[model samples]
Target: MQNREQLWLELPPMSPEAPRRLLVFLHGAGSSPEAFAPVALAWQLKFPGAQAAILQGPEAHPGGAAHDWFDTRAVAADRAERAALAAARLAQRVAVLQQSTGVDAERTVLVGFSQGATVALEMVRNRPGLAAIVVAYAGRLARPIRSGERLDATVHLLHGEFDSLVPVVHAHQALRALHASGTEATLDIVADSGHVIDQQLIILGTTRVMQTVFRGRRRAAGDGRTLH
Candidate 1:
């Protein structure tokens, strides 16, 4: 698994200037960082001030070629354990990226789908002060994590109305948990959608994160006026 972790990170192209914001994407089960290339490209174009980097998960797929954030074997029985393991691995990767790119921890956002979403939430919950925002799609939080802890960032939960894989009910439960924990979180449901990603939903999700980052910067500037 250590060697697998070393091989997991293959960063996409990026520029300097501190990257007004950084989006780190964690791919779902059986998928690689490549799966998020399209969305990263779209984000780069749509949010010029932000840069996107997709990180492959640390576990290799059984009898296959790619990597996964967590071992899916016992996910059904002990998802919280798997999520915790993945979150620890993701924290290492994020630390590496932050050290190399000189990006502020508060300017970084974590986005994921399916199992990837579970990993992202775990990372944020465990490392509360690092990430600026979290965007989770078609996923929920693992159990045993307290729902009364405060977070330094915001969270966005997106789930499909017809997602059979990870039911939308779980997503709502995660949202409620986050709120109970005193974290700022918003949940959005896509009508008639399934487990797959929707173009409009991606746009909406990414836009919300960008808007939050932009608004924060404006507030920090102390101009007494919102950027809008």
Candidate 2:
């Protein structure tokens, strides 16, 4: 049971009329919410009508400096257990954040990198009815969620062609599992890129996905559908 006291950040919208879309960014292992500050700033600027929240991981690392969403112990040995714990804990934190910020689950999008990507995937799997979209960069789905579970949200997997840390194969494996489970997913390959998300690619890919989600929401809203 991880403590929830240290797991949240609320980045308010620039305007009251800003779109209800909430983008949450999850950082990789050994990184804090500040790691994604630049990307969040860019998103806030580009989508001035949206609010972005970057959540810190729960597991604190050595030096009491950085955090991880889950204990990395036996990640390779017992990934299912690790992922399940992380998913449950993260879902709880997300629920609290939504209540505090007044963000609807159906209007929320999750974006993560590296280990953070794994956490996002698990969160989506645990609460498939929520999350409008999931954007994973240089990460793959945890095996627990890949085992025949159906994911309701659209997934965008962005991977480098030569990512030595996580490997391109991991992305392919996740895609295969997603397809087999009938999940809606789209995979984008960044040519000549590496483990780190390039600024240009992040802006391009994230903006495109956000636009798609907003468009769909608008269309739904026009149809007199309450997106809750």
Give the winner by lDDT: 2
Q: RMSD of model 2, in Å?
A: 3.0
Mind giving the per-residue lDDT tens digits that candidate 2 earns over 46-164? 66666787888777866678998778765477875787687787777777767766777777788888888988888888876667788899988777344567898888888998889
Error of 2 at 72 (Å): 2.1
lDDT of 1 by residue, 1-228 (tens): 135344433344444433466678887888886667776676666555565678887778888877777787864777678888779877877877777766677878888888888888888888866688988888788774464577677988988899999999998887777788778889989999999778877987888887777778778779765332
Question: Can you give the TM-score per candidate against the true fold?
Answer: 0.87, 0.87
Segments in model 1 whose C-alpha atoms lie over 4 Å from true places: 1-4, 8-19, 144-147, 223-228
Clashing pairs in 2: none
Per-candidate Cα lDDT values, in order, are 0.77, 0.78
TM-score of predicted structure 2: 0.87
